[model samples]
Target: MTDLPQELRLVTAIPGPKSQALAARKAAAVADGVGTTLSVYAAAAGGGVVVDVDGNSLIDLGSGIAVTTVGNSAPRVVDAVTAQVAAFTHTCFMVTPYDGYVEVAEALNRLTPGDHEKRTALFNSGAEAVENAVKIARAHTKRQAVVAFDHAYHGRTNLTMALTAKSMPYKSGFGPFAPETYRVPASYPYRDGGVSGPEAARTAIDLIEKQVGAGNLAAVIIEPIQGEGGFVEPAPGFLPALVAWCRENGVVFIADEVQTGFARTGDLFACDHEGIVPDLIVTAKGIAGGLPLSAVTGTAEIMNAAHVGGLGGTYGGNPLACAAALAAIETIEADGLVARAREIGELALGRLRKAQESDPRIGDVRGRGGMVAVELVKDAAGTPDPELTKQVAAAAHLRGVIVLTCGTYGNVLRLLPPLSISDELLTTGLEVLESVLAETRA
Candidate 1:
């Protein structure tokens, strides 16, 4: 595994001298808008451990925010990228097309959910893919409005910023955002007070009809397992119902699998869990190991709706990125990482649930496969406790473990460990988390 130690080794404090010095330099050189969860500087990372500039090996539970499913610096990705760089780095696909780009599109078409005739277009980030998906939907349906859900996080760009639900850091003062976007209540079980899947879908669908008519809707996009929206998994029949509604209305149902695709959840794609096939699937994170690659894969007719010269970007499918994606996809299928994701989920869920027995502050623990989270609350009453969440994450960081927090209220401690991490490391990280929770609660 790239000659790095598989175990956590603390040679210095979490952010030792080297890292602190780098942090100081970063403050001066980098923009203040660029915030970091940890102060440590990564020197090398792979197979569950991120060796920092201070030589401290910390267990990686974030996986670069679910972007390194095949593990950082996977051999296959490295070799393919190395060979591609040596041969040729760029030849803009729109200008001088290459086999790598075509191969990646073929792979995405074959792998993403449905068995229908699909077409794929690559891009640089999840935001770009999402924007393009909306564009295609609009072109095909000749509609003007799109709908998103509460607590959703699309991206930082103009159109995606409008799609996202959160404010403050993501959307505050960033307007006037793209218009014709609307938001509706999502099925948040913990807070919904037992609203059934169908009921929740009706609530959302009714709102869409009343506020933004289906006749004007080009698309309705959602995260099957909402990511930044606190990893909230919509109720059992919620997604299916939404898909049916979209079909009846002739509006495209887009699945923003940017954070949930490529087996981050137990299934390869979150929609697979519900047998839901979205008209357009947007993917990015974990698609190319760690390279900057995203795509919009959809039915051929819808994807080709845009005029011949209407779509594409200069760096949409860089050769090296396409190569990395092909290799990473191969690695995932060959290694059976999907099954590994389920195993990680079981191990993590069991530990977290057991911990919740004593700590009433852990209001809920839910997720699929490697994507898991524990919602922190003030008590059994289920009042969000974002402060406690922050303390717990800080405590884990000091103990040579990396964890992340999310949710609309920022009270969910999310864990997204790489599937490549060994069971020992996973267990140890959980142990650290449990200890930290106990201390923080006390």
Candidate 2:
């Protein structure tokens, strides 16, 4: 416990002494392809905060992009990982089977929504899980077309890039993406053009029918809650309608829960909120408490459609990651992190709404569970105020708090605090945000 600082202590500016040095070194040592939010250079992390090497402690609101919901350095995750490393590092689950791999898969099957018998396949990343999901869907239906939604961010891989909506950074100049990939409008309520949930579904489905034709559609992939696309939660009834359409058309429905799963949105799986049982669900991020792991869980028939030896990668189910996943799942269940996510949502939404009342720049504050966000606007007219949002986040950073901005317009401030965050810490983070907004607006 002593490894973590009691409170924030900013001796120098944000990057401070150690972090600045590390950043300079990183510029030379690390790949420039990657992006960073804060350069605090974590020395230790637990509960709701991260302690930087510069000796400054910060209330973590990003939760490492919703990857550490159970908290960074969770005791169970640490113990399990350490034990696994001591036992054996890598035997490749495919080459030499391990109980941890099968155990984690079993957990995913049981934890994922739906009472039907399920099967699970582990992967090295969310992108891999998504790519595999498409393969399974295509194989199951014996179709060639895949339908994705706009503003979606599946991954950086070639196949996923075609499935993803954005192109500037993720898909720029790398096109000639996979064939038979089609896109439709996402259920974005804030910009739904005044259409109802069912109407939005129709708009998307109509396009699918006209362009791709349901006869050739293999899968309809969607994110229950758009993460990088501004944390946009689909309008009510939108998902159910789309899922129903898939059922009637013989298209497999795939839910990309990489960013919204593992209690990030109050439910174990975001699809559960609408009682939507998708044919396949892709999961990652918070699953292994920050470890690199992902999984595709779905109905037995759909997943098994792939011929034997058609699936499985060399490092697909690394022993270390499987151990961490087991421990992480156990931690989430035993510690009641799911309920804690609800408490976080209630506290954060309550404070953010109050702040919005006083600040007109706050266009809208919305989200579920620990995954909340506040969209900034230029004025009462509700034009995105990306500049002000960036300034507010920068101000919060200087004040020893870490915040992240999302949305295509970059005006949405996403709050993904660890579910284990203390009430006091959570309140302090919210207060910091309020203070920053007040100062920025003034």
Highest TM-score among the candidates is held by which one?
Answer: 1
Task: Give the true-structure RMSD of model 2.
Answer: 1.4
What lDDT does candidate 2 reach at residue 185?
91
lDDT of 1 by residue, 392-428 (tens): 9999999999999999899999999998999999999
Candidate 2 weakest ten by summed lDDT:
1-10
lDDT of all predictions, in order shown? 0.95, 0.90
- The ten-residue window of minimal lDDT in model 1 covers 1-10
- Which residue pairs in candidate 2 have backbone atoms (N, alpha carbon, C) closer than 3 angstroms, thus clashing? none
> How well does candidate 1 score on lDDT at residue 398?
95
> Candidate 1: TM-score?
0.99
Task: Record all residue pairs in model 1 with backbone atoms less than 3 Å apart, i.e. clashing.
Answer: none
State how far residue 105 of model 2 sits from its true place (Å). Answer: 1.1
